[model samples]
Target chain A: MSTTARTVVELIVNNHPGVMSHVTGLFSRRAFNLEGILCGEIGNGTQSKVYLLVNNDDRLEQIVCQLEKLYDVKEVSVRDDYDNTIFTRLHDLVTNAQ
Target chain B: MKLSGAEIIINLLERQGIDTIAGIPGGSNLPLYNALFKSKIIRHILVRQEQAGGFLAQGMARSTGKTAVCFATSGPGAVNLITAIADARLDSVPIVAITGQVAHSLIGTDAFQEVDTYGMTVPITKCNFLVRSAAELLTVIPEAFRIAASGRPGPVLIDVPKDVQLQQIEFNTWPQPGKKEGLAYFDNDALLRAAAMINEAKRPVIYAGGGAMYSGISKEVIKLAEKNGIPATLTLMGLGLMPHDHPLYLGMLGMHGARYTNNIVHESDLLIALGVRFDDRATGKLAEFCPSAKVIHIDIDKSEIGKLRRPEVGITGDLAAVLPVLVDLVGADKREEWVKRVETEKQKYPWSSQNADDGMHPLEIIKEIAAASNDDAIVTTDVGQHQMWVAQGYPVKSPRTLLSSGGLGTMGFGLPAALGAALANPKKQVICFTGDGSILMNIQELATLDEHKLNVKIILFNNGYLGLVRQQQELFFEKNYIASHFKSNPNFTAIAEGFGIEAYQVDSIGDLKTTLPLVMAKDGPALINIYVDHTHNVLPMVPPGAANLQMIGG
Candidate 1:
């Protein structure tokens, strides 16, 4: 995780239908803020990868712990080395659309 | 073997050794009921409502520490189960709730009795599933049970579409029943560190929560306390873990705790937290609870370790497995000074039960119930003054005997839960302590109790008001009582008689003293509506957001 405020979280989860709801619902229920999100089905489509942008605050450990407990979530990792441009571009696009 | 999804569910539950199931049937779940009718091994108890079905399942699960099953149909049926499911989540009770939904083809068309059962239950359940096909039932049924009964147990939901239930599937062999998975690992280094901390701390306290109750490590906990000269206090959910009169026991701590107990906990230099989440009710204020104490928290769930107050040494493992090693690792300390201080605090300010001999006080009633009933008789309580009083006053001898809705604090929990306890333990007696307000919420379950005639007793603390709310309003809200009072209180005795159960009333303290023991001794299901003055309040309450030490009125 960066000393900076923003960090990226990557999750490998089962690609079952309604699995996304479990992942995203957990973030909302725990009151963790998700700044940006990107996801796609991995090879064979049996599993999917999700990336979430969030602040690297004190609650980050708790956020990761809660994610690890989800039944569908297979793996969780914090990535300090990531392309910030992608999330910034997405934010810009949404701002322009509005 | 060729079987429908409904048949598979029944067959699987029977294989899991689930003999009794409770639920209300609807058009969507008729197929399951049909399968249930054919299965001679499994008996179904038809609850008056779907929520009661879930709570009834909880009654069985909480009493036995086993996974219990309940069923409901879609829409309103699924909606009603939310409170009970959420309650289970808060208390970490293991129950599997299966609900029926409309056909898959309907999609979001909003057909009759259609609701997004899966979506609604995601936040409440430990895990949930929406069966896409009948074939999924083979894996899903067993998986649901496994998830529900696994470490840090909580409710799980399975929503099967009506068409899926009718869809037939052929398989070579039936799948095995679901079994609970044990703790995979715990850090030995952390364990040793925890032991050293306990050995060194001068004034230590063991604070047990629901996890301790579920782990069945009462003996180990007591050993840890006795060896280290630590005083122990239980959360409401952990009341029965320490015997009511254990020498090292300091009773409950936090909101509605005795002043001395709360004070003693806050004064501790070391807090050994076991399977506890440090909830607001038990901690009063996060910053102020056990402020001087460095904690050693052991829970099966990892997320709870630093969720509220961070612990110095947190061991993420089951207490049943963790405590035995912990008991041996710690060196003994007399802690004469700490023990003397605890005793002095307790002696100087005794609990209401210590002095009050009034026959009509809830404390006396609870003590009398303990006297009349055998040591192991199960007790359940609705959320209110009576529940708090029972937590403070009842002499619960063992774990799983005192069942109350701790986290959710839901009313109407007592009656259906009592029904479940009675059903699960037909040979043993079960008692429900409810108030006039609480009883009315699920009063319809009396019919279920009457039909079964299992030895269950309903003791109603009739105060003609929402007693707890009224008390809070009196203390915190300036006593401008509006909706708290039930001016036209229904005669519960008459209502019980109408429901075809034996009923009695005791208005005076003298009558209450004479009649309670005899009523408790009677054989079949009975209800005793004992009139209580509304002025009586559960004491030693710490107003919300205050420190545990700032307790008021006992």
Candidate 2:
């Protein structure tokens, strides 16, 4: 098993049609890959919380900074304590299924 | 009123005042194309490739500062559009790309021409959508335009399934266009602090970027610089924010920037960076960049404030809104000694190309083009030595006149983008300055140019090599030239002639001077192949990982 240090970037964004695209596009254009993602409406449904699991790299800081620049992205936080085992479990299930 | 998804999309596009769109049709998007055929208001331009379609939209958007549109089919078509979408994202060009997708029922079943476009485009677009039903089209279409055009403009994608386009939906009224809200918060304290720094600083340099161009605050920026007597430098994307020959304007900074400009930035006590992210290329080595300066970073995007270099005072607001306030707060105080010192250095270390009396120099040709066009022509360039030469030699008089892929450094951007610019502004002359290697990447667009008869003058600097890459090899790898040189080159003139455009070939300096005017004077599309020396290099180049001050050559 490859044990790489990973972090979950939680974002509070406007729950709109293209908001997810803006957030994910920032990472993609920078060539940063996402390991896992979970998003759902939060509060009164005007905003949503997006959790992005990504490999902790040198460029991660820059990516985090860029995410905060988006107009629709209300808040961004890098959570080191978030559980990454969900991604590993999903990966294992997918590999074992075939 | 009841309308199909295709009708809603066409109606929305027409409502948005979008008259021109560049794209290629395919199987999945046939319904949308069918709807497009029924509408006479919006004209769809057929491009040779999907990438050209995206770049064509970029050219129009960057030229007009308005949201531009492009369309592509599912899978391969969408994949091809990714490069341009990435380009638009990095450079902050407003483009909305509508792509076809496999029907919802077939999605994730690995159906023919099925790719998860929504998943793939997440990282490249400002925003993207996967519409499951036709009813979603009403809101999605207008939202795509709004998001793409507002607050740090970028590309947005709408991935519609075939079934969704064919589905019918009844609507009482079309969704009204969303009004772009002003920035919710402005730090008055940060503005005052920045003003204080500017007032106290002995040597201040105003560094501008694409944000200044986007905000249309060139006049305010120039006023701020002149009012306080600060020398201004621009990033590659920030070119044309100030007139090329403006008294206080220092040419482009970082990498292939002027040596004196880089030195001036290094020597400054305070750096007023506006609408400019300190990109890696613009700041060679981050630690060493502007080492002596205390930065006052101002941008609409708050995240860009301390992303690379932590600023002493960071003000987040629109350049258009923030600059006028800063101008009023900052008292006019001339730094005579500092200005004189910078002027002395500028004269001391002049940027000059290698003089070759026998053949046409690339810089000379650029100057001739600038002269013939009166520095008012909208110029677009592909990434290479010729791009650097154009940045150095050509004098841009206004913003949106010079468009190039700065952040992504995408090649083959010139021709397609020039096509967009020409189509957007029918009255203005659009010129494409490209290298032999770069031009070949999207040379098929010459057919589009020939068909439209766009007044785009293409000047190809044929050096028979990937000149910039070769220069890097020569300097860094002990001249071990690998795949950089092209041994057998095609006749570009014949290629242009095959496309039914008037073509000229210039091998000498006199020929270039005489041929350029003749080509410029000609009404329709024309191509001029100017053979340049293969060994010529864009000098004052900062090597990879080197500091901005550690530039080599020239």
Candidate 3:
């Protein structure tokens, strides 16, 4: 497969009721179907990290920016390059699911 | 101990800056209605049906850009309003729908008028909540508003059980929303590459979509089109992106779109798809769509790109951000040959139609409506032949000026949508063009319009039949009318009158000429029923599953 250049969006959000709904709502409204989303708790259960991998770097940034403006969002970062580490983690998940 | 749930609802709505609510009272919501009578804080608009309430609320939301609220009882009442909410959601109109559920004790027992209202609404709404307790109603009220207005703007549902509506919850100032987490960082490098593709391509076309209108980037879209010497085509939802009269404007594209527009898109070297999803209607047999084009798809949604068709370059950023850069990067060279080629094609395959005007032509009616309304007036339409006629005949110059259920052509969409538009912008005139069949779906909304005193001009095209279905019969079904004709068509003017709305009937051209000006000048909701030929059809139609060149007429 041709290694397509992609972008990654990392979201840090408050662990609260309706936060996931709101976050998912943004993606649904934007029509951005997440290719890969990995979510887990990061700090003392108050916040968590959400990883979204999109093929287009420009799109990744845009999603990050919009996510940043949400009330429950603590921080957003866009990795323009498809980091091998994230892919490895995703690959592991697929392997685990299988 | 038993302060009614409806009372709490009234108190909560008053706190959320809602002075009025449009809805129908049903068995499940009767308690709420009883409580509403006791509260001096809010005005209740008792519409005839739940659907009208939904549309009225949508109208209010569109006018104010605030969350318009509606109420209904369980089951069919809630379900009846579903189409309107879907309409609002698809058009990005902000609305908050609150439904009354059965008492907690009867929950899941399949009690009278019980249905999974929340489950039914999930796909259409931005978010939904079923308040398990009255303590949550206060929170749900403000949260519903916040969610409906926060990002791209859409409908939200809060289904409150009867028992919860009676429970007491302490009211406080709405909490300041927590911080948003992430940064959307656009890759300047990707934009540069997309810009390079645009600059290098000789046949560049900007296919603007509903996203452009929603993002408020119409001006930017026009600037980019003008700057790059690019001919532009708008999706049905993107009708007003470039002024209809602009030299580069190629009109709407897709199945029913202009032949030249689709042909150019097919042959173009660079396709800049902005704020538009590659819907099947727009793409028309996607395997062969834009076969030669290197697409630069600019959308806020990450999933849209490559979902239907892969783009050469995809920028998932706001049209606000990407459009400016695209406009700035374009060179000073005008594609004169390209412009002439498009114009020649447009003339060759123009969006024209002709009908023997035995009495009234739908196109002429739409044209007159467009001409009479000022630039400030907003026009909305329901689906069918009337919608296509409006699209072809109406010359929209401003973005968001025309609101229609393009993605979901829900019949009976126009009246309520126009009500929402008129309510959204109270100062601006709003008109809804609804066909006879489409209007009957939610015709009771005429009473909703009457009760609210909303200044909406409704142009009801009474053809005594489903014109689109009739057209299909003519072309494919051997002209056998079948179930298409409503031989027992009700007198719409009398129906409007019964609803306490001013009504005018026009059967002749002279009657239309005399009545249109008078109705346009009047205040409050007025219905003008123009008797059109049942046999008259919208022409220049691409027969189903046919190429653009195989249009019925032009």
Candidate with top TM-score is 1
For candidate 2, lDDT tens digit of each residue in A1-98? 55357888899999977687677666666688887888889999999999899888776777787887675788989988877676668768678899
Total clashing pairs for each candidate: 0, 4, 27
Off by over 4 Å in 3: A1-98, B1-20, B30-42, B135-139, B171-173, B177-185, B352-359, B547-550
Task: List the DockQ of the predictions in order.
Answer: 0.80, 0.37, 0.07
Q: Which stretches of candidate 1 lie over 4 Å from their true place?
A: A1-3, A91-98, B353-357
Q: Candidate 1 has which clashing residue pairs, if any? A: none
For model 3, the docking class works out as incorrect
TM-score, chain B, each candidate = 0.98, 0.98, 0.90
State the TM-score for model 2: 0.91
Candidate 3 docks with a DockQ of 0.07
TM-score of chain A of each: 0.84, 0.83, 0.73
Cα lDDT tens digits for candidate 3, B1-554? 33445676676677677767888888888878888887776777777778878877866765444667888989999998898888877777778888988888987899998998866776688678877877666566677777776546678888888888766655544443322122245667889999888889989988988878877788998888888898889888888888889988888877667667778777788889998888777777667777778999987666566666778898777777777877787787698988888888877765552544343678777777777777778888888988888887789888777878787778877887787677667788888888889999888778678867987998888888898999999988888879998989998889999999999988777777778788888778898988887777776666676554455665
lDDT of each: 0.90, 0.89, 0.77
Worst 10 residues of 2 chain B by lDDT: B351-360
- lDDT tens digits by residue: candidate 2, B1-554: 99889888888899888999999999889899999999989998999999999999999999999999999999899999999999998999999999999888998899999888887888778777888789988788888888887778889899999999899888898887643446646789989999999999999999999999999999999999999999999988889999988989989999988899999999999999999999988889999998889999988876777878989998878888889899999999788999999999898887763444534678888877888874468999999999998988788888999999998999999999999999999988999999889999999999999999999999999999999999999999999999999998999999999999999998787887788778888678999998888887888899989999998975
